[model samples]
Target: MNAITKDVEMEQQREDRRVEMAQAKDKEDARERERRWQESHQPRDNLAPRWREVAGRDNWVGMLDPFDPLLRAELIRYGEFAQACYDAFDFDPYSRYCGGCKYSRRSFFQSLDMANAGYEVTRYLYATSNVKLPNFSRRSKRNNAWSDSANWIGYIAVSDDATTVLLGRRDIVVCWRGTVTQLEFIADIVNFNQPIYAEGIPTPDRSVKVAAGFVNLYTDKDTNCRFSKYSARDQLLAEVRRQVLRYAEERGEEVSISITGHSLGGALATLSAYDLAEEREVPVTVYSFAGPRLGNEPFKERFEEILGLKSLRVVNVHDAVPKVPGLIINENVPEFVRRAGAAMPWSYCHVGVKLALDHKRSPFLKDTAEASCFHNLEAYLHLLDG
Candidate 1:
C-alpha cells in the first residue's frame, strides 16, 4: 500500500512539471512573435517614407479652390511656359504613322469608349521613328480629302491677359523628343528590340486630346526614334530637368512644373517628375492618367518623394496601364492593394474612377469624395495620403 502511494505521488509531480514546461514554451513564442511584429511595422530610413508622411491626405486641404491665389499663379506660370515652348518649336500635328493608320484609329476609339464608359483610360504613344507613318502619298494629296489619320489631337495655346489663346496650331499635338544623349538608358529600355527608323515614328493617335492637360506626358523620341543604352537613363533625366528649367526660364517664372499624360505618357511623366526632383532643386507636380509602372520599388519611392503632396495619380478601375506600377512589387495585386500599400514612401496620392462620363447617369463627375475615381477635387484633398 505504501509503494502504491509513492507511485501516485511521483506521477502527479511529473504531470505538474509537464504543465510548467508547456506554459514556459508558450510565453517564449508569444514574445518572439511580438518582436517580429514590431520590427515589420517600423518605418524605414529614406525620403520615400518622409515624403509620404507629408503627402498624406490631410495636407491638401483647400487645394482646389480654383480661385486660390497661389494655385492660380502656378497655373498661369505653367500656361506661359507651355505657350513659349509651343511658339519656339514647330510641332507637326499630323503624322502618317500610328495616327494615320486605321488600326491605330480604332485603338483610339476603343480607348475613348473605355473613358466614356467610366473606365479611366491611360494611353501611351511612341514613334517608331521620326518619319511619318502613313506618308502622304501622292494619291492622298490628289484626293481633296486627306486620310482621317492626317488629323492632329489638340491645340497648343498661349496666355493673353489671363486668357489662354491658341498662338500656334498644329494638325496634332507634338511633344519634345529629347536628344539621343539625353535619354540614354530610358530610350534603350523603351525602344528595346524595336526596329530603328531614321525618319521618326511619331504616331498620330487621337487619345492625346482626350487625356490632355490633366495628364502627365513623357517621351524621349527624337529625330531618330532610337536612343542610346540604358546607362543614359540618368542623362535623360538631366535633359528633362533642363527642359523644365529652360521652359520656366522662357516664361520668366521659377521652376514650377506640372506634368500630365496617359498610359505611356503617364510613365514618362512620372519618370521626368522624379528626375526633376533629383537633378534640380525644384518642386515638380505630376498628374498621370492610366500610367504604367516605370521602375521597381526604389523608382516609385523616389518619384513619390519628388512630387509629394503635389503629385496625384488618377486611375480607372478596368484600365490595365495604371496596374503596372502597383504590380511591380506584388505579383498579384488585389483591388485592396491600394489600401494595403497605403503607407507610401513619398507623398503619393491616388484617385480612381468607376467609369467615364458616357452612361445615362455616369459616375465620372458625380463628385463623391470617398471614391478615388469620383470628381471631387475638394474631397480628394481630404483623402490624399502623403
Candidate 2:
C-alpha cells in the first residue's frame, strides 16, 4: 500500500512540472513574436530629423475624416474658381477682367455663395503653347507637327475678408475650335532616376527620383524642352512667384497661399507648391482633385518632408486616373515585353493624405469599368459639394 501510493504521488508531481514547462515556453514565444512585430512597424532611427519632425505630425493612415463643413465649403469654392480660370483662358473673349467673363464670373459667384465670403479674382494667367502628342496608333512616328495647344491656364485671386491668395489651375478641356486638341493621357516616359537637390539647401545623403514627365511639366521650358514653343509651366510658376512676392511686400505681412488644380492641372499644382514652398520659405497648401501619382516613393517622401500637414489629395472612390501608373502591377508579363518599352513604372505610389469619397453604392466599386465618368472634374466637384 505504501509503494503504490508513493508511485501515484510521483506521477502527479511530474505532470505538474511538465505543465509548468509548457506554459513557460508559450509565454517566451509570444514575447518574441511581439518584439519582431514592433521592430518592423516602428519608425526607423535613420530618418532625417526634419522628416521625423514632420512625419510625426502627419496622419499616415489610409483615410482621414472629412474636413469641417465650413472648411469643406471653402475648399470646394476655391476648387470651382480654379476650374473657372481654365475656362476663362480658353473661352473668355476678353482676357482682361477675367472675373467679368461669363465663365469666370459664374464660378466666382458660385464660390461666394458656397463660402458666404468675399472673394475676388485679381489676375488670370494664360499661355498659348504647343504640346507633343505621342502617336499611340503608330509608335514609330516621332516627328509630329507642333499642335497649337491653348489649354494651359491658371488664375490668381484673393479673399477680401480672409486675405488669402488662391492659385488655381484648370484641367485639360476637350473641344474643337479649329482643330482637334485631345488631352494627352499617355505618360511621356523619360529618365528621372536622380536625387532631387533643393536649390539653396545642401544636398542630403538620401534623395528621391521623380518622373521625367512631371519634372518637365514643372521645370522651366528652356530647360525642359528646347523645341517646344510653349512654356506653360515656366510662365505659370513665374507669374505665381511674382504675385506672391508682390503681395507679401506690399502688405508687409505674411500671406497665406493656396494652390489647387484638377487632374493634369493637379499634378502641376503639386510640383509648383513644392518648388514655391522651398524657394519662398512660405507655408504653401495644396488641394489636388483626382490627381494622378506625381512621382516615385522617394519623390513623395521628399514632398511630404517639405509640406508636412498642409497637402491634401482628394480622390473619388470610383475615380480611375489616380489608380493608373499604379504602385502595384501584375509581374507575370514576359521579361522581353517589359524591356521593349513601358512608359510607366511597374511599381508606383501616391503621396500626401488621400480623402476618398464613395458616393455610389458599395456594389459599383470597380476601379477600371467606370473610370472615365468617375475621373471627371465635375464628378469631384459634385462629391465635394456634399
Candidate 3:
C-alpha cells in the first residue's frame, strides 16, 4: 500500500476501537442505573413482616400528586398558620389572641380572610395543663409559680364558616417554660405498654408501647400526679366538640376539624387527632411539621387504622426530630448514651403519610447534626411557601 493509504487504514482502526469502547461503556451505565432502581424499588418480601404491612398500606401522600394539589397546599398552609398560634402563646395572656401577636403581621388567618373575602375568627379556645416537678427546682432564678404549668397545651379557632375549626398546639418555648412538659419522658407502662385507647374508643388487640411522656402530655386525669387535672389534648377536644355542636345546633352546619403543630406540639397534635377522630367521630385532618415519632409498632398501627390518609407529616429530609427517639434502642446502652435519655429495647415509629422536603438527596438516614437548621418551622414554611 502507498504511505497515505497506510495512514488512513490506521486512523480507521482507531475510530472503530473508540466506537466499540463507547458502546461498552453505555451498556455498563445502563446496568448500573437498573441496579440502583431495583434497590430503591425492592419487593415487599425483602422488608420485615411488620414493615411489609406498613409499606403495603396506600395511605402515604407524596408531593407530586396532581389531583389533590389544592388540598395539599391548603393543608400545608394551615400547618404554617398553626405556628402563629404557638407564637401567640409567647405573648402576654392578653395578647394571646391572633390579632395581638407579631405573627399577625404576616398572618395565615388574615391570608385566609383575604382569600375567602369574608373569613372571621369567631371563637378562640384555650387549654392548659400543670404538672408537679420533683426534680425541677422551684428555687431557680428562672422558676416561678406558673413554671410548673404548660399554659398553652393547644387552642382551637372557630372560623365564621362554622364548618372549619383549626387546632394549633404550642411548640417548646424554653427549657423552663410550660413547653418543658416534654421533659417528663418517663414511660407510662399501661395497657401492656400499648397506648391507652381513648374512653369509649375500643383498644386494639395489639402489643405496642408508646412514649408515656407524650401520652401523659395528652391524657387528662382527676388527680395531679405526673399529669395535670386537664391535658391539652382533652381540653382542646372538649372545646372543639362544644363549639362544633353549638354551630351544628345554631347554624345547622357540621364542622370539619384540622390540626397542625411543630416539634413537641406536633406530637400532641397526633395524639389529639387520634382521640378526636375515634371519640368524637368527626372528620379530622392533621398536618404535623418536624414531629417526633409518638409510638411503637402497635401505636403506629392503631394510629394508621384511625387516621388513615387523613393525616400528613411534613418532614425536612435533614430534620433529626422525626427520626427520634429512634426506632431501635439498644437494650445494653445506658440511658445517658441513648438519644434524649430514652433507653428502651424497642423504639417509636412515625404515623400518617410522610411528605419529605428534600433539598438534596444525600442519603436515607436522618442527619442529627443538621437538625437545628433543618428541623426549624421556618424551613418547613419556606418549602411550603414555594
Say which candidate scores most in lDDT. 3
RMSD of each: 23.7, 20.6, 15.4
Q: Write the per-residue lDDT of candidate 2 for residues 285-386, one digit (tens) a residue.
A: 677777766555545656776445266778877666666564342122444443332334443446677777875743433334544667666556666654
Alpha-carbon lDDT of model 1: 0.33
* Model 1 stretches with alpha carbons more than 4 Å out: 1-252, 306-309, 325-328, 331-386
Clashes of 2: 1
lDDT, candidate 3, residue 113? 34
Candidate 2 TM-score to native:
0.57
Q: Local distance difference test, per candidate?
A: 0.33, 0.48, 0.49
lDDT of 3 by residue, 143-230 (tens): 2333334333444554443113221211111000112223232223211133355322345543445555556545644444232355
In candidate 2, position 346 carries an lDDT of 45
For residue 138, what is the lDDT in candidate 3?
A: 26
Ranking by TM-score: 3, 2, 1
Tell me the lDDT of model 1 at 239.
43
TM-score of each: 0.35, 0.57, 0.57
Quote the lDDT for 112 in model 1.
25
TM-score of candidate 1 to 2 decimals = 0.35
Tens digits of lDDT, candidate 1, 1-386: 99999999999999989999999999999898655333222212232223322222333345443233333223232222222222222233432332222333224323322212111112122322222222211112332333322222211111222111111111011122221111222223332112111112121321111111112122223432222111123334444444444445565443334454444444545555554554455555555444444443333333444235255455444434444333333324443563354334111222311112111134333433333243222212222211
